[model samples]
Target: MSTDTSARWRLRAHAALGALVAALPAWASAAPRFADYPVPAIYQGRAAQPLLADAHSRNYATRLRDAATEKPDFAGRYVLATWGCGASCTMSAAIDAKTGTVTWLPFTVCCWDADVEDHLEYKLNSRLLIVHGARNEQGGGTHYYQFNGKRFAEIRTPPRHAPHPPGDHQ
Candidate 1:
């Protein structure tokens, strides 16, 4: 294709994608708020040692173990352990404070849009996980996820119902 023809085609594709995103359901396109997915209650028991036998966990055993020492930083009873993979790239695993299970994030977050302040945005008492970057360096966009006890699932839509924080209005 001619340079001009290719440029026009790319522009049209971008526009089409934007229009589709705009037409999506609010929950699908909108970022989930931290207050919308609060845990019923925070875990109060002692943090357990990370189970290093988990798939891919042994490679980062030391890091995960060190992170296990800290209180839960994600969901209700999980500590988010993160490490830099390269420039503007990071890998993370969620260490269960109650069961010591390790669940890695679905992909390496990298090459975020310039507007994103944090690559990973999460709340200590909520299951919503916001990724403000490309997943595995495929594309640049904001992705919403929910911790499903085993792994983080990309959210195409928010839960039909979820508990709010203790004092927040319904």
Candidate 2:
């Protein structure tokens, strides 16, 4: 082959190789896998059994709703769990009556193995906000948030309290 032809062929090969490398990350991110984590030992520990047992034995949804609405000074909390696609997850939420401060703990099982990118947003003066899930092994998810009477911007920072299970609802 001529030298100029050979050189052009090599340049095209290098360009093709570079393009393939650049496309790799985008392709990898397009699909992800979610792996379930072992249930927390706290749920199995002696001291924690009673608490877990109580949770298993009772349904407190009605009581929670009542407190949030009936009592002006009520600070309410609850946990909810569900099973899906052979896995289960939970979400919890709490609110302070006096300061109107809210806290939540959101988690999933068998959803993803990647970094947990949970973002919570609360409106400045309103109780409505949005929660965004980071790229997990399970792809990604988003949650619509609302607060008591007030609409507020969502805050990405962690809240002091860890919400249980039920509060994961959008």
Tens-digit lDDT track of model 2 for 41-151 = 211111111121234223534433333342222112211222232333333334333332333333333443234343443322333344444222244454434444233
Per-residue CA lDDT of model 1 for 49-152, tens digit only, reads 99988558988889999999999988899999999999989999999999999999979999976766677888888998877667898766666788978988
RMSD of 2: 15.8
TM-score of 1: 0.73
- Model 2 regions lying over 4 Å from their true place: 32-170
Q: Which regions in candidate 1 have their CA more than 4 angstroms from the true location?
A: 1-29, 157-170
TM-score of each: 0.73, 0.25
Model 1 weakest 10-residue run by lDDT: 161-170
Best candidate, lDDT-wise? 1
Q: What's the number of clashes in each of the models? A: 0, 25
